[model samples]
Target: MKPERARSLQWLLVRRLILLQAGMLLFFIVLLIVVLSVVKPRLMIDNEAAVTAVTGAVDRDKDGKLIVHDTDELTQFRAEHPKVWYIIHDTTGQTARVGMAPPDYDRDLGSLLSSVDHASIGFAGKRDGKEMRPEAFVQKVDTKAGPVQVVTSTFHSRSDSEGFDISITAIVDMARKPDGTADWPRVLPGLLASLGIVLLPIILAMGVTTLVTTPAVVRRSLTGLIGTANQAAHIDFDTRAMQLPVKNVPQEVVPLVNAFNQALSRLAQGIDSHNRFLTDAAHELRTPIAILRTRAELLTDEPETLRLRQDIERLSHLAQQLLDHQSLDRPNEHRRVVDLAEFAGRVAADLAPLAIEAGYDFAFEPPDGKVEVEVNALQIEQLLANIVRNAIEHGGGKGTITVLVDRAGGLEVHDEGPGIPVEEHKNVFEPFYRVHPHSHGAGLGLNLARQIAQLHGGSIAILNGPWQGARVRVHLPLHRQTA
Candidate 1:
């Protein structure tokens, strides 16, 4: 099964913020409608249709004065509300009146125009308590002739049964004709269509702003965590008790890093204790093995005694190999630059006697000039000794063994005996792996040599030599910086 993809915190936060912003926008729209229904602003007017109807019907005559041209829209307004009365004043001081006022409202066009100086519309100083605002306001409109002032008065019901000011929605419902039933689809589309067009830009800008900025905010908030993660990549067994520093870490993440550090400390201590026990055990067995070997050598030349000596010697060799493996793990020793050819020759001379005693001729071939490398001298010597000893033990007890030191900071050892098999080449470097079953030597020599070579930033390879025996090659870096 495929794993589910992980969601990014940055994008997740952006999406949630956008959703919250949309919700807030919706809530405010509802609240505005509720407040408009309850507490009406004194200036809110439902006069767009009247303004458009009057302005669109007037144009310039031969005298450049406003005159009605009798359009269909004006006819419709008159048909919808039979009580509509309007007084229009063009820029040229020309005026026109269409319908008559009621008998009780005996104001002329001039008096009605002058009465607009104050906000309240009243015949004397007071109106009947039932009506607050009749459609009596001075509105300036744009016409083809120029600017014109229009004053209108009409009575439809501006208030509901509870005397709360009616909303534009209720006013529209009241204006529906004939049977007094409202057709909302006919009224709402033109007025409410612009609401979505106006809101579209705001929603897009909000979502885009969230998408662009949330990742940066999340990244800055977790900068310390990112640094800690980079440091965690370098952790390994060689680091021992290394712990992540938590001083600059965020407060919410401190506990997790602290717990990880504690776990690393415990693991390091456990490995250290295990290594210490092995080294101590190897040290303790050396004395007992030597004593038993000495006693076995002193026994008479019987077959049982000879077998006992060989077993004791083998036991002693195994313990020494264990000690060597443990000791090479510590790389704190200081290293110095030395000539590679001179060092290899010295190591070959020291191991030549052991090869001669095993009935093999030993030879050392040095490079033409000096090849230099930075290495710990004692450990390099032990590595060379282990490789030559492997050749002596497993080279079928016959012809010449050659140690060639390369000028390019490497060494090659070749022996003239039955060669190692091609398939077993890689397995020969594994610990406790022996090529010939009856061989009396411990099988950790090549494994230890390979470890030491890698510690110095080098490698080892086993191959078939030209003279019918296994060839072992070692390569080291040329003058590496010491740690």
Candidate 2:
């Protein structure tokens, strides 16, 4: 697979995985909140009933009077502990006695009274009060005298009646404790119990769902990965990307996978075409090299043989350049960090004598400091040689070829040549594309350089240079040193 396409696929997969994890987490949290919210009221009602049952049993005796066997004893007990209040009502639901003024009943006495019934022993009711709503409950009793009801009120130690309300209605009214005063610590245990009850089913459902859906999810993921691999395996080099059918994929990843496959298909075709072109070009160059070698061997010791030798040498050089270019085109070549300034200096130095022989000046101006990048050193050398040679050959031979390296890991080669036409700028980087028909070298120079730059996560571009010269700039990322 092409590196760019592979990277894109990996990125898409990572993004999709993140979104999936987030969605699952959010779904679980919302579900947990909903379960807790729904179960809270029922738990509160159950706890209220339990509290009423326990308190009612303590307030009454077998005879069922507010003062059972010992009235005076009970009163003395009540005086000592005035927080306890009780009332007994008839079966007709009238207030026979008052406990602690039913906390708040002046505004909605009708609603509070209407709710009382034989089955209302543990029912909660609310009444309007001056400051806040007061809540209450009713408890039933069966005494030898008759059926009765008991009510209680919460004591406020900070109020005027020693923080108590001593009215008869207050004495027999149902109690509503102040905020944060009720047995909230008890509610924690209840909440834990409720959570246990609630989570038991959720856990079971999660397990069951995992058991049931996990295989399907895995199957689907495997199917998609397998299908993608299969499609990539069968991809044809000559064709554009085949649009893979992507129906029924997990909604999160469908678009990304589809785009990845499309990109891969395009990349595969590009690399395939490049390989084929390299092969065909190599085959075509072999015949000329062979003929030149044969002709050079035949004219040995003759005066014209020297010229033939030179021609053969030039042909050999071109062939070697072609082979080098082909090798650089392959994507699987190993890469390592190279100092661009140093590499360019060496290349320019090596070619300086050749440039002088050809009546062209060559200069190398490396950056003051080292500029390191990741690339295949030989390929980068070949790239520099091609561009510099092209500059010498086409930039009106006598002009200076200037090689400059910058601290940003950019390399620029400039020469006093007629700038490339804007229209042919893109075409110049295509293999075997040349601007001038009378150009000396083969047209693979820029193409090979661009390929090398791309392999190193860099790029090369041609633009107008200062003083009407052609400038070729190559930019590469800086390399990091590990400790």
Best by lDDT: 1
Q: 93-186, model 2: which lDDT tens digit per residue?
A: 4443433553333223344554464222222343244333233445455554455554443332224134433222211122235763556554
Q: Lowest summed lDDT over 10 consecutive residues: which window, candidate 1? A: 117-126
Model 2 score (lDDT)? 0.64
**Per-residue lDDT over 366-476 for candidate 1, one digit per residue giving the tens place of the 0 to 100 score:** 989888899888888878888888888788899989999886777888988787888899998999888887787677999998998988889999975456888999998
**Model 1 alpha-carbon drift over 4 Å, by segment:** 1-5, 31-196, 220-223, 247-251, 434-442, 464-467, 480-483
Any idea what lDDT model 1 has? 0.78
Per-candidate TM-score against the hidden true structure: 0.67, 0.43
What are the C-alpha RMSDs, in order, of all predicted structures?
Answer: 14.1, 15.7
TM-score of 1: 0.67
In candidate 2, stretches whose alpha carbon ends up further than 4 angstroms from where it belongs are 1-318
